[model samples]
Target: MQDLAFRFLVQLEPENASNFVSLSNLHASSGRWDSVAELRTRMKKKGIRKMPGCSWINVNDEVHSFYVADKSHKCTDIIYTVLDSLLLMMKGEIDVPGLGCMK
Candidate 1:
């Protein structure tokens, strides 16, 4: 995994933020906090910023895109409130491992 990522970074798209983020995620999943932090620090030093991941969905014939820490939507507050309620309900029903849940 590291070999392929390094190849992509060095040969294909060295300046791409996604490459850095993917490598950081690999490190983080392996309990390598220092490596993850180092990768992020490098990205910052190189002026490379990772774009937030987003999900697109269709509701009532309208399409909406949602991103982490997003505040541009008109219904951001209400959407968050509903999501919070759903998370709380899920907490009572089962343990969602690896997912950040309302505490």
Candidate 2:
């Protein structure tokens, strides 16, 4: 599924930095840090500066914004830790129905 999405992205915008950024994000989410770093390098080579990373949350009819490198919240580390934990858990025995597979 992710491969298909990545293919589509590259097809739509072969050299777009935004597409590379999205790809890097996907790779990071999948614990593929090497790929992420590679994509980042590609972006740099293409003279593409990354768009500022921002996140938003709605609370009490107000929208709160956060940016990358903001120390107010440790969002990056927290998410990385969560993904690491999930990877560790996935390394152990896991039951899958119908496919007769275990991980």
The lDDT values for all models are 0.81, 0.75
Q: Provide the TM-score for each candidate, comma-separated.
A: 0.67, 0.46
User: Which candidate wins on TM-score?
Assistant: 1
Minimal lDDT window, size 10, model 2 = 94-103
Off by over 4 Å in 2: 53-103
Model 1 ranges off by over 4 Å? 1-11, 93-103
- Candidate 1 lDDT tens digits, 12-91: 77679888888888888889899889888888888988888899999999999988888899998899898887887676
Model 2 score (lDDT): 0.75
Q: What's the distance in Å from true for residue 58, model 2?
A: 17
- Per-residue lDDT of candidate 2, residues 32-94 (tens digit): 999989877877777778667898988799786778866565466786677677676666544
What is the alpha-carbon lDDT of model 1 when measured against the actual structure?
0.81
Show the colliding residue pairs in model 2. none
